[model samples]
Target: MIVSEQYGELRGRAFAIAYRMLGSVGEAEDVVQEAFLRMHQTLRGGEPIASPRAYVATLVTRLAIDQLRSARARRERYVGEWLPEPLVTGPTPAERAELADSLSLAFLVLLESLSPRQRAAFLLREVFDYPYREVAEFVGTDVDSARHLVARARTRLRDRRPRYHASREHREELARSFFAAAGQGDLRTLEALLAQDVALHADGGGKVPALGRPVTGRERVARTIAAGMTAMARFGVRLEPAEVNGEPGAMAYDARDRLVGVLGLGLADGRIRTIHSIANPDKLRHLGEVSDLGLRARAGERPGRET
Candidate 1:
């Protein structure tokens, strides 16, 4: 069979896997494209794949893992904050909700705690439900090593409680409320809505000035974010809602509409639990345009708005 015939069926799964692995849509796209190119090269050389879907998935996973290894160095030097690129896919409500938790900002941040190999092992086994042997093969390790890696990653991630498990609509509403309060500079409302132990993390790739450490406590985060937003407004920084990790989030743009930053929200029990803001210019390459808040507002007005 020709490559084109199989491309459509494989692309979504390939992208999904790569996105979960790299946490950047742009990187995921690059990995998927590279995987396809390799597939084509093999096919043109008259090599047959035993299972095209599995073959493509494996190829993408390997490419993403390699990319992650390099990305670690880049992230270490990032400007202010580093956030994953938002994925705004057109999917059904059910499908979008199913992916929301796995793709959320908190989840992606938690993945950062693991080494690249461990991340690959954990994602394959947990997210993709791959058997230990399959994950080991994908990462070029023994089954026991892969199992250990997955186990270690899981233990670290378990500390971070799961975010919103309610319906997508409910979660989106909560995000909107948070955004509205932040935009309006309603400190009282913001503090009330945020959990007492809320944490704010910024990934600036060490290029931009950002909080070098995580900001914890509801009062401290609220004051810090509010002050930052106040300064941003003075310099014409704008925030607009965008989809990050399949959930409601925001992106920041300067007066020139240049992509400045991306924000990710972590919601627990209908309150803001964590905030991740990525301001590194290098990381914002995937966010082409400064998303207009007006547009997002209108989009949300529609019934059953699914991120």
Candidate 2:
């Protein structure tokens, strides 16, 4: 029971670490659960293991690294642009702001560009605040190699991330306006709300058809959104606002309550700069369970309005 309680207490942070590493809730939860199982077995075996928390965390991190390595092949052959499965983060705590910021879809997308080892090394050293020595231990490298890995990762990530810091209320408000305008197929309003260099990326993962490449520029993105919203509406799909990854996002549901897709937006200078759509059924499996957005969407939404 003490072991179980310890596992429970550490589960949130464990899940957070794994999720940030792998960008998939189901995969992260699997890693966390496996770590707990291993820890429980080791404890029950009467083995002398010190610091259950640290041991379990390291175990989870290594497990997530393996998962990331294996997941890369599928991602390479992915139908469209691959995206991190949305985690549907709720209100951010001031104390956990660092963790919250690292979970953004845009940030996760940037992390995706790195190799599995570099990602693990960088995440451990940077986001999780582990020292270079510890990050080396986590990624199974020397301290110098770990430092090099983090530096390379950081250089690659620089300027690839959104200029974050907008209030959730502002993001949500903008999301509401964007969806309403897009739902109505109002190109003028859509263009006005979009940044000049806005980019829209859709991930369907070959299970379904989506934009194979990013649609960039305000005019192009506006055309894509307007056409997409209109086409979805014709197919009985409805778009409703839902908070995703601690930012304003939307949830799409068909008339029969099946989830169509999940979307997250990156706002810069109070305008939508990046739009991410995840329609891959494989990636979306956990959104039904982990996504608070799913319930409101399943409950029902009115047409052409914010939820």
The TM-score leader among the candidates is 2
The candidate maximizing lDDT is 2
Per-residue CA lDDT of model 2 for 124-149, tens digit only, reads 87777888877887678799999999
Cα lDDT of model 1 by residue, 1-307, tens digit: 6456567879988987898888887888899999989988998899998888778878987898899999999878765556676654446677775566677777877788889888888888987888998888888889999999999988888857365676767767888888777778888988988899899998765555567888999888888888777756765677887777677788787666767677878778778888887765556666576433323322443222223
Q: What is the TM-score of each candidate against the true structure?
A: 0.83, 0.88
Task: Tell me model 1's lDDT, rounded to 2 decimals.
Answer: 0.77
Model 1 quality (TM-score): 0.83
List of clashing residue pairs for candidate 2:
none
CA lDDT scores, all candidates in order: 0.77, 0.80
